[model samples]
Target: MKNKILIWGGSLLAFLLVVIVVLFIFRSRVLQYTIERVITKVENKYPADLNIGNAEFVDWNSVVLNDISFVPHGLDTLFTTDSVYATVSFRSIFKGRIVFKRLEVSDGYLTARKNGDVNNFDFLFKKSETAQPVDTTKGRNYGTLLNRVIETAFDNVPDQVDFKNLNASYKSPNRMIDVRMPFLRIDDGYVESQVSILADSIQNNLRVRGTIDPGDYNINASLYAFDEKGIRLPYVKKKFEGEVAFDTLHLSLTNKRYRNEKLTVRGRAMVNNLILNHAKLNDEDILVKESAIDYVVTLGQNLFEVDSATEVRVNSAKANIYAAYQNKPSKIYDLGVKTEWMPANDFFGSLPAGLFENLDGIKASGELKYKMKFHVNMDSLDYLVFNSDLDASKDFKIQQWGNTNLQKINGSFVHTVYEYGKPVRTFTVGPSNAFYAPINQISRHLRNAILTAEDAGYYSHKGFHEEAFRQAIIKNLEEGEFARGGSTISMQLVKNVFLSRKKTVARKVEEAIIVWMIENLDLVSKNRMFEVYLNIIEWGPDVYGAKDASRFYFGKEPSELNLNEAIFLTSIIPSPKRYRSSFDSYGNLRSHKGYYYRLIGGIMRRRGLITQEEFENLYPNVKLYGRARDLIVTAPDAAEEDTTEFELETIDLLDF
Candidate 1:
């Protein structure tokens, strides 16, 4: 009885051993057949040709595949190659969970071509108007179908997987060249990276560390993407570090009912020692140290939105620039911007030529603030508008004689107020000399007269005054002539600061907007506003600002003009060209218009700005001296026109 039982047990053990040997012996064929079956299913759905070589199965626990290649069925080009080896561990074989291990790829290549709007991978998957229903039926028959579907889905996925070592190259023709790193792993719907890339002729080296959730279609990479362009997108390269770091990049794709929605890019960049040549008023090179930039952008449904900020710190200077944008077909909205310049003089001197040439060597150290809001509409040329404000400091000075010299200049004005579609007004208050007379006494007198007539309240208003503008407008309309402008001193200052001398409603509107902006800004003080106005305001032909005017006319300090001299200077404000010239020693008009004196006297009296006695004292016939011929009365010539014949012709025509 014992021998019989032993024999039965031995037989059973032998049978089990034989079964294991047979399974091992045919393992390679079994794996090959299984892989071929999966490939066939994938081909049916996506039309792809797959090549498999030297597949082996191990103890019914795992399978190894070597030398695999895949190509689109209709396309003759190979898309990928897998060499060395791979093992599919059968830990969850019944459930079709493929855990790959020890994969190696060699001399693999991927090529993609895109032209116009056609992408090479557009046909990678089976075309379907709607997603197919999932098969939930059980039993071997239904199980086969489900397994085939899952295998087909995995085969159609776009991936380059390799372990151990991999050498891969990609050519896109229309896209950029790419060379990828070795060692790839995929498990549990997760693709973890141990990868690097050499792109653009291998001139750029990119290091990438990230994770991709294939099931969720999301990717995040911490990248160091750079080239030798000396120009970088989003961030600039700086010294100490030759490359900029685009840190913590993230991207995600989500499929909705109608479209595949994409959310792209969340990251920041760090660049050290960014150098900008000739960026300041004096054409000096600037170095931004440890500059950092942060940004986020999203694109979907043909719309793109971006928000970014930059912080730069240089030698004794620091600046912060913030910007945001929403791109749309009808309009571009400039959400907002705020730029703060600390120790502004350091950068001010580096501005380009023709921008602030006369301001060179000015030791102006103060905060400069700028704020603007506006929109541009592509549908209509007239649909444009913006409002801006600029403010600075009055304590700024000109560097001369190796020392910082303060002009005792304290003043302020509104820089801009209207743009696009808004009504605007502006005002200013500064030293009389800064605005009207920076040159010599004669030039100062001429400047004063011109400014007073064109924009009064130049020395009193705080950058804007609606009431004054209203009164001036009404007065001009009542006179049936556009002889007077209602702009304040700040408005005129703004015009001088940003534009040339062109008399037009558009120019006026722009000027008013700028002035209003300056008035509302906190970066610039009232006094600083005044200083800039004085430095830029035109005094006369070839004369600008109080300093130049003072040098040209009185040959004295801007502060030296007496009250009578000031009044005389102010009187010529309306027509400097008619009044600016040497006259006879005698009070009689010489080389100038007698009408100018009468006109000034009349205006002063009508405005209640002068006494009757003072008006009478300025009459043309106050005194007489010098040779009669040399002192012969010469009517003031028009500054803009010169022609004795034209005058005679006019007289003749009038007589006729």
Candidate 2:
């Protein structure tokens, strides 16, 4: 048996030696056949033609290709290079896969063109809708294209890659750009590149340096983008370090899925002299002298936290913020913001041009200070609660109301407070005679009840309620509809008095701007703003203002309104035109509305607006009309002129 084993081993060894010698003698022919097969496969799979001058194995471990050119099937050459070469390790092939030591490309040019939505190069990879039937084996696998390429070429990352003298050009319907990279070097997982880019009207220079560790799943990168004049663009001059991973990966925004992963980034960002294109601020772009921020942000599986956020301000206000968002069973966010004293006018001046048409028109000067703590559930924003305060060192004044300004607002405003399709307002507010009751003159009970129902933070916050708005957005997401009216009394007043009844984003922004002016500029006292709101708001159909609403509903003066009457009045403000729905045919309050009335009454009582005895004695069965003789005209029709057109297109649908 031992002799037989020796003979068999000797024969195997001799056969292996012969096979190796044969392979070595025909190595060049084998390389030629392999290169031809690769070229044929590429041509068959892509809508493109390939050209090659020569392919040679420069040494034992290197392959070089010369005069390579590629063109889309119907278009000009997309890319051309004088030479391309790759050096690999032969020993690593015995372990498992080939490992590249170095790759170099010389004197390459790439061009891309787009006409409308279609591009010349897109046809090379993107299949045509009416293309012929494809053989699965011959077609490229797009779904795993990235993985396949990475697996094949980067099974073991290359030690270094160098590209020299590369020029890239892109042409689109709206713009043309040229990019030149004199040299690009990637070594040991670190990349360093410098590029000069020229566009139709802009010239930019960019330097990018980054390190990537795929094994550790981490990356650190910095980019600097500046114009020829050395001005940094907003997206330029940024440094980011983080770890990211995606689950159920998809490139589409709507279908992408994200898994909870911890990402922590610490960075300082800057944008010198950012310009915004807008028509309203003026015909020219709005120039922001400076905008920057330094922050530390951490995101966990179901939570996001910003531990420090400091806005860099040179000629504007200084603001700092700390915020966190968590979604364990439900989503919640807590944010604290503070702003130091700064020029109020400068703050507005920094906003979009024409967004606030006249800055100097409202003569105001003061240093402002603001502080706020906000917390809310994203699930139901209407139930949000918060505390905030905004004050100035000295009260500023608006001496003049421009033609497009808020003070020029003068007219008898009529609101069809009820009925969704009813005309809610008419400009021809005749005989602006609705009795204006001061905050002190109005019943404390009514004031407290209204606050409890409408906005509990009315006196404490500025024109905006962040928590409520955030909650509204969260609840909107859940319901697939906007079911909350996250407006504060100040916002409502700005919407009613100074702006049109149009429900639009522009209107909302303008309303907030006006409110900021009113609050920050000290244009009016909080009590005065509230009084004006009560006087101008539509309490019911044709019911304009609180005094009219009081007389129409309770047959009493605003100051004489009791707790129950006050709650009922506040309850209908959300849907005054639909107020009749809360009452039965006999004019008795509905059971559900009665429940809401009692709820508001209880809150008012708990808030000390009404005594415990009054709360217990408060009856929810208050009828809208006591008797036929007691009924008074709540909404008196206003006189309309020829130009005054009243059309009801659903104003307020928020449920309080």
Candidate 3:
């Protein structure tokens, strides 16, 4: 019995040893085959690279694979990873399934770059021939191995991917990067974004939040657009920067059969502190220095259809804009835009012959609203209507206003026009008799008195006039109103040339600074400055400038005015409408003749421009051409002389 048992035990041991050796010999080949199957499955479903070193089954239930790695080409450079590592379980080896318990990756880097219309990773999958062929002769069913491997590999991945200490960077040419947020992720068609990116060149900050589906070609991102650039285009330069955040971004390609199939996307986003600098679009480059601007904006969009509602938002430190349906070539659709305060002077402040040349400085702020309807096929616009109101205030010392030195003026104009590619018609109306000269001609005796207080050396002095300003300030304090302005003639000219009608301490300071700059300019430029100021100064009513007002009111040129007419024109300079009121009523001027006499006396005492004799002759009988009418009455003749008939009768009797 002992001998028989030994033989049986020995035989069992031999059988077990054979089984163990066979398993050990096939382990490495089996492991290698399993990895290759996984690679083949990945290649079929998506584009990827999978490579493996020798793999070995360490024990019956565990596998160790060396140098197992994947490199997916065509992914954005922002999502590049150096290598991946994981330990997989072999318990399901007989069942033809892979179960990975742990996965880890290292040396991952991300970056984004914008170059015109092309973005990175757009060229991926261009070379499909580079893909490797799958080996189908492995373990498990030969025909089903590829599909199962693919299913297993994709199934084990988490819906949300986690990365450890990721870093990202981005760049664009010619634009200062205002804000940048590098770390980002997407899972289940939703993107997890934590980035703050800005660019000074574009003058805006984007707070991006949303989901992006790379496979379906849909993206949902939000942006905040602001315009603090403070300048106009062609020569303006400004910078800005800020942060942005987003929520619930979603996008998908809709296959609905209704109206052309489209890609729809939606999301919400917010932005803060966007910086802008040196923002300009030029038909021809205008050489100028640039400034920096900062501001913020927030907006949201829902159910955006790419085919129906293609929209683009451009925000930079200098400007903000939103445009939609811009790609349609045959029709003009819905479009909207909003722009912040920008001044012509601020934009062209440094240009030699541009908008800044002849002005003191500019104080400009307003809104422009318009609707444009057109036919894209004909490249023709139908009707563009807009409403804009602007007020320009000018003050001049040495500048002429109908033969009088213009002190200051507040002028406003409202314009509305309809255009079919070109202006069809326009209508404008404003304060009648607002012109200075007509009123001045009626109050001529007061001309010398007003001129005595004006600065004769205004053209030679810089912006500051210590004596004049001090006297004007004292006069203003005494009057309880802005009765006097202290600006120099050059300063006044500057203010009138470029600025708006806003009266403020800051505007005054800016005017002073710009006028000071004018003194250092050349003689020709100084004269040109004077010319621009004279031409733009508001005289009265709808009238502007000496030449225009002289022609309209007196039927004479500015140089043709006599002392009486010139002084009268000057008298109305302060308040043309008041003079017009006086002219309209005879009693008003008759009662005020004493005041006019006193004004003449003051003009004489001040070394008045006209002689004392000339002043006396003109003061009392200032002939206003159309005041009253002269009438002559005539009676019908009753009796007529009869000398011819009596002489004829006496002569006839003598002749017979």
Candidate 4:
């Protein structure tokens, strides 16, 4: 039995040696045949053409190739190379596999082109007929899958790599970017690259140096721009109509561990001398000297979370943020931001441009702390939680104003209203303007009616009405759109006085901050703010202020406006430009409006702004006596002048 076993083992060893020798001797022939089969399969599967000069194994572990190119059908060449050489693992070759250990590429180019919405590189991601549709409703085990993918990708990277004289270009209808890398090398996972980039009208030189450890799953890299001019981001200018640049960007992945079905990744991301600009943001560039986020990310079964321990620093401000998103059981989102007690100036300076325009360049004293918490379940939006506040210390005080002064509303000042970025009307907010009326000069009924129609809590609230804002957020989230506004009487006044007419989230935030400053700092009296709101708000196509509104509707002075006329004017305040729509073809107010009129009048009567007799006799009837009379159409199409949605929205938003 022992002798038979020895003979069988010897025969098996000799046969294996003979097989290895045969594979090595005819490896070129086998390679040529394999290449032909692969080319045929790829050509049949995709809209791409492949061209090659020749491929052969030059030595025991090296393969050299010439001219290779790949072009999308009916488009430019996506990639082309003059010559390529690689040294692969000898064991892998013997195991019928080719794993690259070293690589060198000389003279190559890659390009992409996009015209309008058409692009030449989109086919790469096109789904095939056999591909299965993604089912996002089901929970995914991302931690395990992602860890495996990372390990596989890193393991595949060549230990040594070199690229000489490569050019990459991207052209679009709006912009073009050309990149030239004279030399890029990686030896023992130490990387260095010199890149020259031209982005449309801008040119920049950059250097990237890094160390990568595939086995340890660690990487540290830094990007530096020559001349300290910052590396202007490409394509963003054309895509978003903005310029984003950074002087130095440092990134580090310190550790990643997978345990107990959870993956934790810790990293540091930083940028210095960041510059941002856009017309909607600010006329001048918004600059940040330094910003960084030291983050710890956790991924588990159907869950992704940014640990609360993560610290974020922007300029002189510091804060901690925690966020989590879950897709199992029910789609849920949670976010929290807790800011340290920072200097008032530092806090104001950290506010993003456009979002906090009113606080820009504002000088302040004392300390400010802010905190916000938000959570929502997609299945039950009504239960969403949102709480955000600024806790200013007692020592807090505004030392100087920013873009616009809140105190300017206290006294007579020229107020200009803009429409579509153009100044449409310029009028004084005080008595100097003929149309401007004081709080006493304005009719009590008109003032009361406007208050009831817009914000009944205008007198009690300092600047914001939390209930209204909460409802606005809930409704907006439910509809997945900004279909409603939570502006208070104070907010409206500040928007008209200190901000633009453009309706945007940024504008709303700025308006809110300005209103808060004005109310909290006691910069303007409630009476004066209400008086100014009555003086500057748009009343009709070309009319403004209460005096004009009273005259336009009833040909009466501000004090002469009656209850019914005041209600009609107040109702139109929500949609002044479309005020004509309030009346039907015969030029009479719609009957449905009477219901809201009585509802608001009831609130007014209870507040003692109007007598019981006035409430009982109230009617939604008013005659247009000024130029507004010509705006009413005798033969109006209901759809052309429909204001039902706008009216319902305004009435529902009324604080009363």
**Candidate that would win on TM-score:** 4
Error of 2 at 84 (Å): 5.8
Lowest lDDT block of 10, candidate 1? 644-653
Which has the better lDDT: candidate 1, or candidate 4? Answer: 4
Task: For candidate 1, write residues 1-656 as lDDT tens digits.
Answer: 99999999999999978966765565555565667677887667665677776666544564555667666755545465555445565443433344454454555666665556544454653334466643333212322333334334544444435444444544455345455555555544445444445453334444455555545444444444444433332212222222333222333323211123434444445555454432211133334444444455444433455543444333344444434343343444444555664555655543322333233354544556556555544444244444555566665433341121122223333333333324243334334334443233333433454444555555565576655554554555457677666666666655655543545443554455345434543334554555565555444454455555455544455566433344444444445444334344323334344454555545655555656665555543322112321333344542222222111011111221
Who wins the lDDT comparison? 4
Which tens-of-lDDT digit does each residue in 555-623 have in candidate 3?
A: 565556555455455556556445454332221223344355445444454454555456445542222
Candidate 4, residue 550: Cα displacement in angstroms equals 1.0
TM-score list, all predictions: 0.49, 0.49, 0.34, 0.74
Pairing residues by index, what is the TM-score of model 1?
0.49
lDDT of 2 by residue, 401-452 (tens): 5445554333334433323324545433334454655556677777787788
Give the whole-model CA lDDT for all candidates, comma-separated.
0.46, 0.62, 0.40, 0.81
Q: Sort by lDDT, best first: what order?
A: 4, 2, 1, 3
In angstroms, give how far residue 343 of model 2 lies from its true place: 3.3
Error of model 1, residue 225, in angstroms: 8.2
